[model samples]
Every structure is written in structure tokens, then in C-alpha cells.
Target: MSDTTNDTDAAGEGTATSDGDADRPTTSVEGAGEPAELDGLAVDEAVERVRAREPDRDPETVRAALGFVAEDGVVSRDALRESLKLTSKVLTTAETRVELAGIALDDAREAAESVPDLPTVEARLEDFAAEVAAVENRAAALGEDLQAVVDDRADPAARFAVADGLRQVDERAREVQRTADEIQFDLEAFERWLDSHAVRVRDLGEDLDALAASLDDLATAVDAIEAASTGDAVETAAGEAGGNAAADSDAGVDDPARAWFDATCSHRATGLTVADLRAELGDLRTWADREGADPVGEGGLDDLAARLDDLDGRHGALGERLDAAAEPEWTDRFGEAVAAVESDLADCAPPVDWGVVQSTVEEHRADIGSDA
Candidate 1:
């Protein structure tokens, strides 16, 4: 029976009892504690306790309490009412109250369309406006705190220190600017000097190169002149050889030995016995004998006279040619030498007969060949 009474109290409904006991409340006010009497505590104190404990309680503990109450089939309408009033009081003082107030006003206006309760909605709107005013006061206090922080950053001593540093930097910048100007002036002067020196050096290099080229050209001209002189000497030797061959060819018709002897005598008479002329005449006589031609006689004498005249004419022509070929400065000396040789040949006279002269020449040639 005791268990049955406890179960009835847990169910939150009055149990049927004997007599007047049925009219009495069945719940045990003892287990409910002071919190169960929702009307006894002030709404502000209740809100404060709920807010503190709710933030600290785990979700499992809250869920377990709810489940236990649900299983017991217990419902406290007064506690529920008190909790709702506490929530409204707490939200009025919250930082987001203004935003919440706006949301609540919008919700109330939307609810008015579905329900005919203008007076209730108007009362709720007035409550929201009062809460918003409190939030505005809190926001104004926060704004003042932010301004104080800003003012501390913009203090007079701090501003003065910044200004002093800026002035010093400006003065130093001007000094640096002056130094830069001086450096630029010096650089410009150095560049000008460098430009002038560069031009002079380039001109000097060009002049040196021209001088070297001219010297190279002069050297090449000298080499060409020397080569030409050597060629002339070779041609002269060849001409002498040719002349000797021609004389030998004419030997059978002339007394070459007699003519040579007479020419030598005439050269001696002029106080000029050139060894080269003598050697040439000697070579002619030897070549004639080597060819095995006839000795000289009267007919040979006539041929000899004709050959001498032909030689004289050729010598004159050679002199004229030499004069034409000679440099202006060298022509006079060359002409004089040619004239002397012609004069000596013209003055020559022979005493030996052409036959005897021919025999003597043949003997001399034999002697020279034997000696060689």
C-alpha cells in the first residue's frame, strides 16, 4: 500500500483516497524542495541560477533529468511559467537584446496575421522596446571604452615625438640631396674629359695605322725595284751570250780574230783596257774554233769591215734606247759612257794582215782552252 501511494505521488496526479483525503493534494512537497515553489523566489535570482547552472551542466545530465521527469509522468506548470518569465528578464539585459528584440517584433507581427491578438502583441512589442533601450545603453558604454583606447594612442607626447623625428629626417634628406648634386657635377666633368680623351686616342690610333700601312707599301716597292734590277742583270748576260753566238755564226765570212785584236789595240791606245771587253772577245774566238769554221782572208776582211760597221750602228741604237730607259738623274752619265765607247771604236786601225791575225787568235783560243 505504501509503494502504491509513492507511485501515485510520482505520477503528479491526485490519488483516490478514503473520505476527505480525496480532496487533498497528493504530491510530496518535501522532495520537491524550495526550487519546486516557483512563486517563492524572485524572477531575477531564479534566472541567474538557471543561467549559471545551465552553462556548466553537460547535455547528458540535462537530458537524463528530462527523461526521468517524462517517465514519472510529472509536469510542473508553475515552474514552466516561472522559467519563461526568467528567460524574458535575462534576454532583456543581454548584449544581443536589440537584435533579438527586432526578431521578436517581426515574429509578433507575423503571428498577429494568424491570430487575432493585437493587444497581446502590442504588449510584447513594448517589452521588446524597453529591452532594446537597455542594450543601447550597454552598446554606448562599449563605444566609450573603444574611444578611450583610441585617445591613448593619439596622446600629445606621442604626436610631438613623431613630429620631431620627421623634422630630423627632412634635414638629413636635404643634406643628402646636396651631396648628390656635388657628386653629379663631378661625374659630368669626368665624363666630358673621358669623351675628349677617347676622341684623341681614336685619332692617334688611326694615324699610327696609316703610317704603318705606308711603311709596308714602301718596303714592297723597294722589293719590286730590287727584283727588277736583278732581272735586268740576267737579261744583260743573256744578250751578251746572244751577241757572241751571232759573231761566231759570221766567223767563216769574216776575220773575227783580227777584228778582236784591232779592237783591243784601239782600246789600249785610248788608255782604257776594260778587262770585261777583252774577256768577251776572247770567248768569241774560242767559240768560233769550237764550231770548226774557215780562217780569215781578203774576203774575210771585207766581211769583217761590214760586221764592225753593223756593230757600231747597233751600239748607237742601244745607247739611244738606254737613254730612253734611264731615270732622268742617271741619263747623263749613261750617255757619256756610250759616247766614249763609240769614239774608241771609230779611231781603231790594224797593222797585222787578216790571215795572220786569224791564226794568232786560233792559237790564243787553243792556249786558253788548254789552260781551262
Candidate 2:
């Protein structure tokens, strides 16, 4: 009854549609025939009044009922105003939420952009792999060179005539070995340095210079030994002829078998000594070019030490063979003094003690009447 009365009163009060359309509702604004502007405080007060008047009805349902009037019905100004404010608030809140969502999307895009691209990451990984490969290859080459040097010992040279000449060659050989060892140490240090450094060609130049110098020294030492060995071979032939003449005059005619045995034994001893020296020198040359070309792995120093120990064992075995071959009969023909020298030489290890073998060969060359 109240609703009908309110609608009749509104129409009667000139709040009806201007066009007199039977299907559409008309605004409550007097002569303007349009919706009135809504006020926030006014809308709130109208909602509260509607809630109080209805007691049990929802304020939103009551506003919807009066705001969107039926055909030929009038819209309540307070209800229309309240509905407009409610819609504006909802649209504003939705717009704020959309803005916040947009900001979050922008932040996510920025974070994604900050990460390295796939190609860039792949390139870095490839660079690191290449560096590692180079280092490993270098280490592998070094180990191979070192092993080759340790195992090589198959070539022979001419005999030494003079002990002094032989000693000089031995000294030079030792110098070459010492320089090689120094280069090895430097290379190891360089490898360690590389562990913490980038592999730049310019940065490596200084170390390369030092290695080159060491290589030169090794070459020089090797050359000196070659010269000494050549010179000693010539002198040894002359000395053997002279020693034989002296022996024939002092001891009278010698037995042909005894002479043959002396020559054979002398030749064998000289051959062994010269071969060992030549092999070592040749191996040193082979090792020279490969220095610093490889990288060692973890515990490389310990591994190198173990390899050296193995080398020592090999040297010891070779020493035993040399000693066994340096028997009394073969050495005694040279003289008691030369025999003693030969014995001492045979008693020592190889590489480190190879000088002793050179000395023994010189003693034999000086006295042995051997054309063999």
C-alpha cells in the first residue's frame, strides 16, 4: 500500500516521465527530467533511513526496487543517488585492483628481463669448457713428455778416449737435466697460477720467456755433450793405439784369444755407456718442446713424485745390470786403477750415476787394445 501511495504521490508531484512512455521509468528530478548528482554523505544517510524504515529488508534490495522503477513508475531520488554512489565505489575499487595487478605484471616482466638469455648462458659455459680442455691437454702433454724422457734409452754413440773429456760431457749432461728440472718446477708453478687466473695470451708471455730461456740452456748443454763425445771418440782411438804399443813392449807378445777377448769386452762396455748417454740426451731434446704445454690434475705433485720414484727403481735395475756386466776379467785388462774406477761406476744408479759409466768407458778406452 505504501509503495503504491509513494508512486502515485511522485507522479502527482510531477516526478513522472516527460515523454509519458509506458515502458520506462522517469527520474525524480523536478523539471530537468534527468538523474540528479549523487552526494556521498547524502547517499549514506538515505541508505540508513531505508534500513530503519524496512527493519528486516536489505538496504541494497530496497534501493534496487526504488531505483529501477517499473513501467510508468517513478524512481526515488535518494534510492537512485545511493545506487549511483555504490556503483561508483565498486568501479573505483575494481579499477584500483586492476592498476595494482598491472604493476605486479610489470615487476614480473622486469625480473624476467634481468636474467641472462639462453644464448648468453650457453656461450659462457662453452668458454669455460674450452679453457678447461686447454688446461687438461697441456697437463696430459707434460706427463707424456716426462714419461718419454724417463723411458728413453736406446741409442749409442762412439766411446770416450779421455777421462777428462768424458767428465766434461757428463757434467754438461747433468746441467741439461738440472735445467730441465727447473723448467719442470716453473711449469708446475705456472699451472698452479693458471688455476686462479684467466688464460690470457699476453699474461703468459713472461712465463713463456723463462721457459724459453731454460730450453736454450738445455739445448746448450746438449750441444756441449755432443761436441765432447765427438772429440773424445777421436782421442780415444789414438790413445788405444798408444796404450797397446806400450803393453806389447812391457809384457811381450800377448795371446791372440786374450787379445780378442779384451777388444770384445772393451767394445761392449763402451757401447753400453755411450748408448745410455745418447738416449738420455735425445730424450731431453724430445721433452724440451713439450714443456708447459699441458695441465696437471689434483695431487699432480704427488703423482710426479711417485713417477720419479718409479724412475729411480728402473735406474737401480739398470745399474745392477751394468755392474754385473762390468766383471773383473773385462775391467782388469784395463789396469787395477781403471778396474777400480769401472767397479765404482757399475755400483751407482743411472741418470744420476751415468757419469760413473762415462768414466769407466774412458778408462777402458785409454788401456784396452781394442779396434772393435
Candidate 3:
């Protein structure tokens, strides 16, 4: 799972000419990730590095590490440097061929200009086009190969023994990149559709339906939560006193899915209490501990929402109880508690269902899943 982070990058960022906010596409929210540093690496080696160490890094950063370059889109700097590095000899040979082809092309063009024969001109033009297309195709192939290592690793632990830590790092980085790409695609597609399609002006029925569904789900979640939180005799037996209250959860119960969601999701402005988050986590543990329950199924959306509601409640309560007057003191206390949990969770690498977590509550949070 990831942490919450803020990004100031937006659409038409470097290309913005107008001062109006309307013309610019901007997204600002903190999500878990760091910019990847992948300069001065051979293509294969750099890609390996990305897989092994990029799990916690941002998608954009992962792309950077993959030799995607700072520029984006079809003609971007993606894999260009790495391709050159990895296939310098081949590129050198290709360049020599291209230079020779260019000389031939220029000679043919001069002859065609001087002679003005239709057949000769057509032949020369075809040859020139063929040569240019060949070189472009070669360059494209080289770039694709360089990117493959970064983006196309085998499944996790499939080659774990063979790859050691390198494959894992690459996989993590690739995943982040994929997520970023998907978000950009979805948002741009939606924007395009909305702009072009003017099917209706207003639709209250859909909104009402959504609200009704949300309320019904919320009620079910409340009931499920109450049922799950009754007690935990096993947790008590696991040492509720002395052995570290934080150390009592079952193995695989301390995943970062929810934490990542909270840290990354939208509408976050203040402190969400550690104790309350723990309470929700405690409930999650209870669900996991339930006999024959779907531990990995993640329960119904309502159950998930109940925990989220608790998270928001604690967040609101904390905001009300501690205003901006005592910022420094509260920051220190909150930081310590969070840091402690982070440090502890670091030791427990629980499996996460990232897809479910990202999409579950994401329907209501506008563009939260996308880099937008």
C-alpha cells in the first residue's frame, strides 16, 4: 500500500498560455509515492532497479525511472536513452545505414529535380520513404524492448528466486506506471465524451438513486460493523496486556490497503485519529477472525463504508477538538503515532487487494483514482 501525498502538476502545465483556470487541467492531492531517481543506468539495469525498488514510489516517478523521460505521449523520450545505451552498437550500425540512405536520397532528389521524369521521381521517392520508415520502425522496436524490461516482468515471486529483489522492484514500479496510465486514459476519455456528447441537461433521477443506494449501503455496513465488533477473545488471549497492544493482530491482518486509501483518497484536510483508525482496523481483524468468513473478499461495500465513516468521524472530531491554535503540539503527537504504525507495519508485508480498494469507494470520490 501507499501513503498520502500532494502533487501540484496539472494539465496544460508547461504549455499553459492563458491565466484562466478553465483552460488548465490540474490535480492536487497527496498519495503514496516518491519520484524515482534512475539516471546513469544501462537500460536493462535501470529497468531492473525500477522493479526492485519502486513499489512505494509514484506512478509518474516510476515512469521516469523506466526511461520514459520527462516528456510524454507517443513521441516522448520514453526508452530512447535506455535503448541507445543498451543497443549502442546496433544504433551505430543503423545510423551508418541511415546516413548512406540519406546520401542516396539526396542524390536521387537532385537527379529527379534536374530530369523531371515521373517514373524516376516515383522510384526515388518510394525508396526514400522505405528507408526512413525502416529506421523509424527500428527505433520504435528498440524503445519497446528497453521498456519491456521495466514494464513486463513475470508475476510476483514467479521469478523471485531467480530475480532476487530486482524483479520485485521492477514490478512495483511498473504497476505504478500502469496505474498512472490507466487514470490518465480514463479521465481524458471522460472529458472528451462529456465535451462532445450533449445528451441531457439535467438528471435528478440518477442522483436520487445514488443517494438512496448509499444510504441503504451505509445502514447495512453499520449493522455488519456492530455484529463484527462484539469482542475478540483470541486477540485478548494474544496478549492485550504487556506484549505491545499494537502487536496483537493476526498475521496478514495489518495490511496497508485502508491506510493507503485514506492517505491517497480525496476530501482529506485534517488529522484522522490513530486510535479510531485502530478501532476500524480492530473491526477488520474481527471480520478476518470470523469462522468461514471471506477474509480476502473485503466484505460488502457498506461494511467498508462503515469503517470509512468511522475514519471520517474521528477526523471531524479531532478537527473540532483541536483547532489551529495548538498546531505544533498536535502535529508532533500525530506524527509519532503514525510513524510508530508505519514502522511496525513495515515489518509485516501483508498482501493487498489494490484493485478492489481503488475502485470500491472511488465511484463517489470525483477523480480520486486518477491523476487528473
Candidate 4:
């Protein structure tokens, strides 16, 4: 009957649930006496049992604490069992919260359709970063408490205080997990906003690529003209011993040499323009400022299109110079390079790989050089 009553008390019978009347578990060590069952078991056997159950636990710490609790080396089997059970329960609860929080965090990350605009997403990420730092600080404090538990092995009261501190840590972890569950992000909406802007950015990149290709064509045309002049100069000098034949060749060679000097001037102009374009591509601010376009502001697509039109103007101006200085047959090669770039731009979709486009331009540029 006494055991039945004690069980009922533990189950909250005859206990008020109302505020100021609720029965809370106390960490007080003012109990009547140690249980007889604890006195019956040997110290070594009880410690060994705890070690078997908790392989990760520091056996020496448990042994030292139990040794201190034992009177004249006679340990309490029931006390050891109760301590192990409570410790296991506390540790399991804390770890379970951590695992659940991890699963919730991973789920949140996976569910994210996209990150919103830079400034907004950065603010959101900062909040989570702070939460992570808080968790790390709490874990460090818990570790210090664990060390205190080991250091206070000779004092049962100090050990009990440390145990209470661990319980508080567990409670805090549970709260953090609850917060994680409550917080949700509207990632799908963010994705739509991002994709809308991404398309315009992609178009700007394509336009820049077309401009880069035109510069490459001009450079290749200059190289072809220089090569032809050098070859003609070499041939004219070699055939000078053949009197009239060499004299006849001089006019044709002089035309090529004159064209080479003109193309050299064009080369310098093309290089400066190429360098300017590279600088714009290398810096977002510079690119945005090109033709006073604001890529991230209202009517960004219109601004980018205007910038593209400016690029086209530069291309037409440069192509005219290349064609006038280049051999008539080489005009076809410049058109081919432009055609290839247009084909690539048409095939590209949103989230364009500019590296691949550049590489394709390079390959086509190589073909142009080989033809020259």
C-alpha cells in the first residue's frame, strides 16, 4: 500500500496542476537515507555496469565520483542505477533535440527554391549565423559544467548543482528546436524574383560576349594583314636578283605593305577598345555604368538592351575599319565569326555559362587565324 501510494504521488495524483500549487521535481539532497539496495552491491560491479551501458562516457570520472559517494568502499547499487538512468535520460533528450534540429535545418535548406535579392538574403542569413553562434556558446558552457561535475566529485551538493545546470542546457536546446520548427521562409516567391532578374543579367552577358567576339575578329584581321605584308616583303627581297620579275613584284608587295601599316593602326585602336571592354566585364560597377545603365534598378532590362545597342554601334564601327584594311577575301571570315557568335547567343538560355561562350569564341577565332 505504501509503494502504491508512492507510485500514485509520482504520477501526479493528489497534486495540484495550478500555478503556485504545482509539484516540481527538486534537486534537493535532503532525502531520508540512502537505499539498502545501493548498499548491497559491490562498487566495482556497479561502475562496470555503467561503463558497459555508456561506452562513450568517461569511466574514470564515474568511478571517481562513485568512490567519493561510497562510505568505507561500500557503494549503493540502487543509487548507481538511478544516476545512470537519469544521466542517460538527460543526455538522450539533449542529443535528440540536436538531431531533430539538424533534420529541420536540412529540410529548410532543401525546401528553399531560391535565395532572394542580395541585401535581403544577406540579412536573413545573418540571423541564422547568430543562432548558430549562440548554440556553439551554449555547448561550450555545457562542456565547462561537465568539467565542473568531474572536479566536484568529492562534494555531492556541487555535483547536484552541475546536474541541474545540464538540465537547463537541455531545456535551452529544446527551445531552440521549437524556434526552428516555427520559422519558415517564403523561398518560392524569392525564386520567382531571382529568375526574373537572372534572365536580364543573362541577356547582358550575351551582349557583352557578342562585343568581345567582334574585338577578337578585328584582332585576327590585323594579324592576317601583318602576316601577308611580311610574306610579301620576304618574297620581294628574294626575287630582286631576277631584275624585271622583281620590279614587277614591287607594286603588288608595296600595296600589301601599305595595307599592313593601316591595319597596324587599326590593331592599336582595337586593342584599346578590347581593354576597355575587359575592364567593364571585370567590374560590375563599370558594366552597370556603361551608357549610364542601372542593371538592378527599374527598367533594368531596357537599360541593358540600350547598353547592348551601344555595343552593336562599337562593333559596326570596328568592323568597318577591319574590312577596309583587310584583304577582300578576309571580309567573309569576319562575317563568319559574327555568325558563329549569334548562333551561340541564340542557343544559350538563362544562367548562361560565359566561360563556355568565351571558349567557343576563342575556338572560332583560332579558325579565323588559321584561314588567314
Candidate 5:
């Protein structure tokens, strides 16, 4: 056998024992030794290349082949050859595992980055809500103060001052409303953009909740301001001024200014008067003349004109009663006259009875003269 033991010894040391030492074959395996050496070199090179490619790669998996060699008992050249081949296979698998783990880590990081910080967004929204509430509360308080001023039983000058203040507050409230509308528009636009971006519901909810709360506060503020600056308050103040002027007139103090003021105010309030009636009659006559219509006769016109004349005659009698009582019933008489004139004008047909109308006017004038 050409010294088979010597050839086996020359191949390398530490080969695994056969099933029985006495029956062991002592010979060098040619192809076996060559493949093991090549495998070991390939494994070493692969480990180095992987480490270079991924600087942050886990050292444990890469060092797994080396650790296997050091532990698990002594290995012969034949055994070492087997180890190297097995280690190379294991290193290849470890590299694949490391690559997969790296991919997984990258995907996890991207997912984390894409998510919004919901807590931070919620905190910001809460802060905005607080600010809006504060503004609304202040506006409401100002409106209440305005209402108190309007309700106060004050003099004309004082009432006028309060009214002016109320006007200013109303203007300010309108400005606030405008601002709130603008902010709401902006919020809607932002929400639409967020929707397009497919933002998370939890985050969008936080923002929308704040905005809705703000809108509610703004609405409350507007209601309060409107309540304070109501037309009723203005009218009440005007009524008080008129009553004072009337009181002054009834005191037998013939102040022309007071009389005019009382007359104007009472007429506005009650819609009455003799002068108002005369003016209405004049307007009706002008209208009839312009439209080429009769003040009486045919259709509903005759009935309406007769009714109006009767009403005017009744009003002239009432004026005599007011004069006898020495009460200023001008407001009441004016209202009756205006109604009569309006009714007559509304019922006037073509070919108005100008003669009857003229005669009726002279009779009313004579009655008014006698009453005066």
C-alpha cells in the first residue's frame, strides 16, 4: 500500500476515528482535503465582505462559525474540512438572516416616521380651545354690560350715550363674527388638506374638536351682543324721551320745541294725527290726479271714498272733543285722517269727484277752525 499510514499522517492531523479504531482505514482522501480548504477560505472571505458591507451588522451571527470551531471537541484535518464546509453553509444562512433582519428594521423605522405625534397635536388643540373660550367670554361680558346700560332709566343725553356705546359694541361684535368666520374657513381648508393626505383620524379629531368648540363660543358671543343691541331697547329709550316731552307740554308750558318734540315722538309711536291726515289727503289727491282717477263712483271706489269721508268727519268731531278736554289729541286725529286718506286713495276710480272732495275739505277745515 506504499505506506498508507505515512500518507494519511502527511495529509493533516486530528482526523475523526472510524467506527472501530482497529478496523480504521489509514489513508489520505484526495478530493476531501481540497474541498475543505477551499470552503474554509470562502467562508472567511464571505464573513469579511459582509462585515464591510454592513458596518452595523450584528457581530454574533457573523462570529458563529468561529465559535463552532473553538467549541464542540477537537477536529482532524478531515473533520476540519467537514467543519469548514458546514461553517460556510451556516455563514451563508446567517448572512441571509442578517440581511432580512436589516430589511425588517428599516421598514419598522419608516412606519414609525410616517405616524403623527398625536399627543402633541392634542395638546396644541387644547391650548387653542382655551384661547377661543377666553375671547368669547370677554365678548359676552361686554354685551351684558351694554344691555344693562340700555335698561337703565336715564335722561335723554344719558340714553343717547348708552345707545352710542351699544352701537360701538355691535360693530365690534360684527368684527369678531367676521374673524370667527375667517378662522372657520381656514380650519375647513386645513381639514380638506389633511383628508387628502390621509391623516390619522385621532389626530384630525383633535383639531376638528377644538375648531368646533371655538365656533360654538363665537356663536354664543354673537347672540349675547345681539340681545344687548336689540331694537326694542332703542325704542324704549325713545318712548321715555317722548313721554317726558309730552309731560312738559301738558304742564301748560307752551314751549314750541317741546310741543314739536312731543308731537313728533307721539305720532311715531302711535301712528296718529290731524296734520298727518291732511298730508295723506293731499297725497291722495295728487295721486288721483296723476293716475287720472275719480275719488268716488263705480266699483269699490264710491264706497271707499264715502267711507273715508265719514271717517274724516268722525275724526273732526273727535278733535272737537279733544279741544273741549284741552287734551293734545293731535296724534290720534292725525292717525285717523291718514287712514281715511289712504283708504280713499286706494278706492279711487277714474273721473274723481273733485267737487265733492273740495267741499269735504272745506267742511273739515271749518270744523278744525271751530275746534281750535
Candidate 6:
């Protein structure tokens, strides 16, 4: 062996080794024997390309690739090729990991891009649940009011009470429903906004603000409704003490048909389900909700009118009492009055206030004052 068996040897000289050594990895860089200047620009450009292509690669792998053939910010062709091979392998591995991570790339991108807003989404979801609860409760109460009205139609006060309750329920239900729709809309808008951040980076603050405002409004409205209900506002409006026509009037319409009509002539005609209108109106609403699919399929408006006509003379208990009290007591008193009027005319002679004579004569309706 030469006294100088160094890395500075010529190309074929350093490569001339035992077969086992040849099989071992080469420790020398590109241009092993030649004195060539290292390319710094080329190294940085290649590293930048690898980084650009595989940003999520292992840092250690990236460092290893960058340091493979680099020495003092200088790189050789042979070292650059080996570094590129490592970087390509790392890039391929990163791609495989991303593909097999059991999540979508778009979802991953969205997660990374919107790192700070996740808590806001979670909070909004909680708000949505609460609002939905309120809305559903309002709808349920309205349904109950409608049902109570349908169940009993005896007292006008109670009927009007239910109507007022129905109106309140309808208003409250529709209000909450609007809020629910807005909440859903805002949430969907936020999702769409989040997804489009890549195309046009938009913050979710505006959407969040709008949703917050809507929730605030709903809270105010629900609070008002609750307060009105708990306090005397709604009760006074509902006429708890008075406004019951039935209470003021001694007669209960004396007829079921007239009573139902007088009570329900001004009621709203929509949004009622079968359970809400369970009484006289229940059948009508149920049929309407079924799209005119009446099971019996026989009775129409004419039949309903005929049924009302059947109750023309059908008086209730109160009507029977009134009729009995207002009946004539005695017919003998009328005859006595006529005999007295004839006796007065026979004895008193003419020009004796003919008006009175005529009045008595006409009331008696007998032959006592026929001459006058």
C-alpha cells in the first residue's frame, strides 16, 4: 500500500478496494478526486424544493437529507443526488401518511387553517341546542292550548281564554321558529365560510356576531314571554277575572250550534293539527291536514249546515228555564179588565179621555169598548 492512502487519491485509486469494501457505502462525496467548488445555491434551491413539496415531512428526515452531502453550506453533485433521493423518499412517505391518516385532506386543511375558531364552533353548537329547546317548548305549549280549546267549548270566557292563549302560542312559536331558522342558517353559513377560507380567507367573526345577535334577540323575546306568563300581563290580557261572556250572560246560547259559531267565527284557520283541534274544529282540521281524505267520505259543508239547522229550536237547560218563567200566568185577569172598561164607559159617558179608553179597549181585545 502507498504511504498516503488518503481521500485525496485519484478516482480509480480510492475506489480500488476489496469486494466487501466495495459493497459498503461510499464515504466520499461527488467528484471524489477532482478539486471542484461546492455549489451553495444549488443546495439551497434543492432543499427549498423538497420543503415546498413535503412540508409535513419529519424534521429529522429533512435535516438528514439537507446534511447528506452538505458541508459548510456547500454541496457536491453526488451528495446532492443522494440528498434528493432521501428527500423524494421522505416526500413519498409523507404523502402516504397523509393519504392513510383516516381523514380527508380538505378537512385536514380546514382544521389547520382554522385552528383558533374551533372553540367558537363548539360554543355555537351549545347555543343551538338551547335555542332549539326553547323553540320546541313554545311549539309544544301552542299545541296544548289548541287541544284545550278543542276539548271544552262550554264557557265563552274559557274559549276566549284559549283563543288568546292560541294567539300567544302562535306568535311565540313563530318567533322561536324564525330564530331557529336563523341559527341554522348562520351555522351553515359558517361551515361554508370555513370551507372557502382557502379560496378566499374569511374570518368567522362576522357570522358569529350575527348568530350571537339572533340568540340575544331570542333570549329577550323568550324572557318577555316568560315574564308576561309569570306576571299578570298575560293573565289580565287573557281576562282571567272578566271578559267571560258566559259569566255575564245567564243564557248559554241556549243552543250548541249557535254557541260554537258565535265563539269560533273569528278564529284563525291555519297551522292547526289533528290533536290541537280535537272537538268541533278538530274534525275539520284533521280532514284538511289529510288533504281532504275523510275516512267516512260522506259529509260535506251542506251536511254540517244541516246539522246546525237541526239545532234551531233545540234549547239547552237555561233556555228551558227562561221559556218556563216567561209563560202567561192567568187569562181571567184580562177578562176582568175588559168588563171594567165597559162599565166605566157605560156610567161616565163621552169625552172621558178616549186615549185611556182606547188603550184599555185595545189591550182587552174584547167587545167592551167597540163604540169608542
Best by lDDT: 4
**What is residue 114's positional error in candidate 1, in angstroms?**
2.7
Q: How far out, in Å, is residue 172 in model 5?
A: 1.5
Error of 6 at 306 (Å): 79
Summarize candidate 5's per-residue lDDT along 8-52 as a digit string, tens digits. 332233432534333332322223321112122334453454355
TM-score of each: 0.15, 0.18, 0.20, 0.26, 0.21, 0.23
Model 4 TM-score, 2 decimals: 0.26
RMSD of each: 60.2, 42.3, 26.3, 21.3, 40.6, 39.3
Candidate 6 lDDT over residue span 1-372, tens digit each: 011112232112233265644543233224344222223435555355444544675545544444544656554434433333333343333333323321332344454354333433344344545555555555445455534533322222122222233344344545545655565565555456444422111232232233335334433433333332233343354476566533333232233222222111101111011112122223333333444433333344334334333332221322232222221221132334434544654432211233444554445444423422
Candidate 6 yields a Cα-based lDDT of 0.36
Candidate 2 per-residue lDDT over residues 168-267, each given as its tens digit: 3233334433433444344344343333222322233343344335334433433333343334444566587775433223222133223333433343
Query: Candidate 1's residue-wise lDDT over 62-92, tens digit each?
Result: 3322322121222232332232233223322
**Candidate that beats the other on lDDT, 3 or 4, i.e. the better one:** 4
Worst 10 residues of 1 by lDDT: 1-10
| Cα lDDT listed for each candidate | 0.35, 0.36, 0.35, 0.45, 0.37, 0.36
lDDT string for model 4 (1-372, tens) is 011111323222233354644333222223323321223345676466445544575767656655533545555433433443344345445544544544544454453334322333333344544554565455445445544443332233233233344345445545654543333232333333234445435644665676667566665655566556445555667677554443333333334534443343344333334444333333433334553545456545555546655665665665565555555444443655555654654553323334455565566556656444
What's model 2's lDDT at 255?
39
Model 4 pairs whose backbones collide: 38-76, 38-77, 38-78
Superior candidate under lDDT, 3 versus 6: 6
**Which clashing pairs does model 6 show?**
277-282
- Between 2 and 4, whose TM-score is larger? 4
TM-score of 3: 0.20
lDDT of 5 at 154: 24
Highest TM-score scorer: 4
Which of the predicted structures, 4 or 5, would earn the higher lDDT when compared with the native? 4
Task: After the best TM-score superposition of candidate 1, give how far the Cα of residue 175 lies from its true spot, in angstroms.
Answer: 59
